[model samples]
Target: MLREAPAGLPRQAELAATPFFPQERYQCGPAALAMTLGAAGIDVAPEALVPQVYVPEREGSLPPEMLAAGRRNGAFSMTVPPRLDALLAEVAAGNPVLVLQNLSLPWVPLWHYSVVIGYDLDRTELVLRSGTTARTTMALSTFEHTWARSQSWGMVTLAPGRLPRTAQEAPTVAAAVAFEQANGAAAARRVYAAALERWPQDLALLLGLGNSAYAAGNVAAAVDAFRRAVAAHPDSAPALNDLAFALNAMGRRREARAAAQKALSLGGPWQEAVRDTLRSIDAAPRRR
Candidate 1:
């Protein structure tokens, strides 16, 4: 496998410094999440996350619970594409991936969660912080077999300003929105800003960045972001409408009216919103 790895992927990579928390009983979810969050610079313990992710009734945690816990702790957490190559790419980029595996047969299931901290392509083995073991190495084929039973589910938790190496725009934006809902606009603003650097021409990311800034009370920055979105996608009605709204908030009534009019002229589903913005601009007295 090392001999046939994709270009730019290292033959072997290991994030040995990734933290570990041995699970107690059916607490692999919390333990694995703790390790991933810790590696992303969050000082959290498995016990602290037990309440957030652990389901005592089921004796295990759910995937949504695990992701929400990550977001609550200020990380841009998201599920990665279900592919071994995608997981390896994240690990090679120094992001530990939390993976779910059915360690038993399909009908007889033993669901488990572990953090993949390293891989040796030459040896065709993966290193993980598994149950009661800080460093457990499994053959790639065995790991894949177990992982396949779980539908290859995997997720990555990243600190603000960081992104998965193989991140897609839509998932990244969804993660930012989820982070905003869990944390706050300020933290999500940073997430959106960082994503914009990776995908400048992305309309959703630009709008997200601008909307987050506005929610955080930085109208000027919001206007700048929305202006950039409109510049990149001139035909985007939502961008022009948002830009108009932000400009009006900044007391730039004339420019706001112009943008709103343009948005109304290119109206689609956003026609009503543009009309409202123009009405507000007209209702407000001109600045002296």
Candidate 2:
């Protein structure tokens, strides 16, 4: 995650054009969220996002609600590993990163969210779109101290097919699953395919591709993807069971039985699914 600052960017850079939507007190979450979505090319305002993120009992927005709000606006949100290098890379790559900082002491927490838009390597400074201020500057060291108090927690939300600089397979796949559960198979297919392109051997992503394909009635595509997933991880019973199901759908009874048997031998969390697949194959009319 330690990427050198690209020569393409200047010593100091800022997204001065980023719009500032004024926020009421205790609404920094919505305000920072509005700034993030706006920078991502979504024009939602702070007020419109209030009900989506605010929690009356907690007196602040919750992370799960914030993630859901991002998805509702047609993007996927996932946390990045807490590191200065990771943060700078996102800024250099033209993505505004939403960061959690303790404006006060760690023990006496003043949790605040701000967007990191730019940085100056020579001067060791960062520029943020903080609450009530369009452009706020803080020394990199000072910013690190505040950010560290929150364990450098940060997040990025992007439209489908747009990978973040610090993207990882586990979290990205988890985000994809949430998107699939909320939106549907079609949107999730894009996420699975995109992630597959990046991490070809990722077992979860491969399973996601196969599942989405199966749900969409593209059984041939499902078969091909499940085969690839099995090839990628032969020990994955879920992959073998899914391949068996796809084969059964394609009328390849022998291959289907073999796959199901292999899955059953592996003995995983999907044992019942494998057993069910075998029963279904037994019930189906034998191929001539």
Q: Compare the candidates by TM-score and give the number of the best one.
A: 1
Q: Per-residue lDDT for 189-253 in model 2, tens only?
A: 87889888889999988988888998998999999999999999999999999999999999998
List residue ranges in candidate 2 displaced over 4 A.
1-19, 285-288
The per-residue C-alpha lDDT of model 1 at residue 204 equals 88
Candidate lDDT scores, in order, read 0.90, 0.84
Query: Which residue pairs collide in model 1, if any?
Result: none
RMSD per candidate (Å) reads: 1.7, 3.0
Candidate 2 TM-score, true structure as reference: 0.86
Q: Report the Cα lDDT for residue 263, model 1.
A: 92
What does candidate 2 score in Cα RMSD to the true structure? 3.0
Model 1 lDDT per residue over 2-105, tens place:
23566788988899989988899999999999999999999898999998989889999999888999998888899998888888999999999999999999
Q: Top model by lDDT, which number?
A: 1
